[model samples]
Target: MRPFQCLIIVALFYCPLSAAIILTPTVMPLNIDKGGFAQFVITNNATATLPLEVSVHQLLFEPDGSYQSATEPAATLMVFPPAAMIHAGQKQAFRVQWSGVSDLPASQSFFVRFAHIQLTPATMPAGLRPSDTGVNIQINYNALLHVYSDRQRADIVLRVDDEGSARLTNLGDRFTYTNRLNFEAIDSEIQSQFETVVGDQFIAPYTTLVVDAGLTLPAGEYHGREIGF
Candidate 1:
């Protein structure tokens, strides 16, 4: 009898083939006082040229916090290079400009969608049919683009937990950044307290955040705060 061999395989599914495209600082902040302009950068990390279709979408946040595409155009924001190609190992900046919409509210948001656009001037495969000609690899990404008239001033309310998610609420007009969470815990049994620094994260305006800071406080209290770098 012969012994049988086993094999294991891994795959990168639903990802761009030859993907070398990346958008840095995914979370962007816009200051209307700063001339209503923000910059987003895309770096092509692949060895082949990267093609993309970039467009801006207006957002309407539902009562349940889920947002949907709005018919109202993003008249305030305009992104150039709606369609472009990036050479391998190169970087490109997409400028987001505001057309000076009058009486702008405290804040407004948009979703910048980067879609795959295949580029081929002349190429054909053997026995290619019309249906096969339309086939191309799909690779895409997007980012959260925020344009606000005011800076973030959070009125935060925090709740502590030892083994579960800690809750935080912002009662202010501005959103609280999650990356700024700090934790201090006092163990009732040992009577000890310690502090920690959390990374940059965000909580929307009038929204709540539930996070687990991995604090082991048995029969004790926990406290969390935010820090600005």
Candidate 2:
């Protein structure tokens, strides 16, 4: 658990039409559960009035691999202030609760999208700045999911040319860092324990220490349940 205070920088410039607002998570693929509760807080940093649409939509990937959404079409999730407005530089918080169960593919990742609309109203103040409508919007979503089997470990093999010849060694205490894989850690406490390393070369579990000339590669992608001593 962490106390989060994220600062989003959005530049507002003078424009003829409404300026496009940018919204995203500090990290990719904000995690949430299928049947859970989530609360999102939207901050209005523009110098003009803002009308935002709060809802969820099918996640879409942008040309450059970013994400964007305008609204939610017939989503089962319930959101507060379904259609509302926010003042310039002011902040508004909303709560959302989803009631459904979804089964994601094992060892796979997925994503969902939420949209916010900026609104301009006819109620004009006596003196309001006419600058770019750039505003920073941050989402704080929270969800709860039923815990599945919490004791599952994956046995991944790090091989060279798909051959069964490779070396293995642990990096740190309870943490095994290997090569050739970019793994993103979610809500799991991960650590690698260093087993052993033999000189510049690696030793295989129950295999020869030498003879092939070049040193064998490293294999540390496999994981298993920790057996209590």
At residue 41, candidate 1 shows an lDDT of: 83
Which tens-of-lDDT digit does each residue in 56-148 have in candidate 1? Answer: 766554322345655554666778866778877888888888776545544556667666645343321224443666666444465666666
**What total of clashing residue pairs does each candidate reach?**
7, 13
Q: Pick the lDDT winner.
A: 1
In candidate 1, which residue ranges exceed 4 Å CA deviation?
A: 1-18, 58-73, 100-104, 118-137, 159-166, 181-200, 211-226
Worst 10 residues of 2 by lDDT: 1-10
Which segments of candidate 2 are over 4 A away from where they belong?
Answer: 1-35, 60-76, 102-216, 219-221, 224-229
In terms of TM-score, the best-performing candidate is 1
Per-residue alpha-carbon lDDT of candidate 2 for residues 1-229, written as tens digits (9 for 90 to 100): 1111111222333232223233433222222343344455555555666665554543232322233322434254566767557777677666555533344222111122233333233322333333443543332221111111122222323222334343332221221113222223311322221222222221111222211224233333433233321
**Candidate 1 accuracy as lDDT:** 0.55
lDDT of each: 0.55, 0.33
